[model samples]
Target: MSADCLFCKIVAGEIPADVVHETGATLAFRDIGPKAPVHVLVIPKAHHADVAALAVTDPALAGEVLAAAAEVARKEGLLAHGYRTIFNTGGYGGQEVFHVHAHVVGGAPLGPMLSPR
Candidate 1:
């Protein structure tokens, strides 16, 4: 993990967050700035800049993140209907934070607002 990374700090417990769930390899928390009623983010404890970078050498970790995301969506009560798992990569994809995180959004009508802002 990069020492200067914000997500790393949150994973290390140096920073406080509204954590919803966590495991040995991952951490799930409410988005500080949520866009939906059930907006949560699941991320690996290790620091990865983005999903594209994560897939290059850490496919297993990538799988873990995705699996955990689905689990959180179910746990957060979005399974019966539906939810969206978004991983914005790079600046063009709206990845403002240089950390690989899965956004599990639900509990609302997510019709046309998913496009890049």
Candidate 2:
């Protein structure tokens, strides 16, 4: 784990988070600045720069992250309605944190993936 990575800190308990679920390889927590009613961040406990890095270097861990996202969505009661899992890669993808993570959002009608052009 990188000493400077925020999500790593949270996974290590060096920094506090509203952790909702956890597995041997993954951690799920509420987003501090949520974009949806059930916005949660699912991350691999191991440090990865981003999703692509995780996919290339640690695919097993990446799968764990996806499993955790689905678990969080089920626990949050989003499956009955619907839920979306997002992975923002790099700066252009809107990834504020460098760690590999997935955002599980639901609990309401999210509507369009983007505004109509």
Identify the candidate with maximal TM-score. 2
Per residue, candidate 1 scores C-alpha lDDT tens digits across 1-117 of 888888999998899999988888999999999998999999999888999888996999999999889989988999888899999888878888798999999998788855675
List where candidate 2 sits over 4 angstroms from the true fold. Answer: none
lDDT tens digits by residue: candidate 2, 1-117: 999999989988999999999998899999999988999999999899999999999888888888889899999999898999999999988999999889999988999997797
Alpha-carbon lDDT, every model: 0.90, 0.92
- Among residues 3 or more apart in sequence or in different chains, the pairs in candidate 2 whose N, CA or C atoms overlap within 3 Å are none
lDDT of 2 at 91: 91
Give the Cα RMSD of candidate 2. 1.0
Which ten contiguous residues of candidate 2 have the minimum total lDDT?
58-67
Candidate 1: list runs displaced more than 4 Å: 113-117
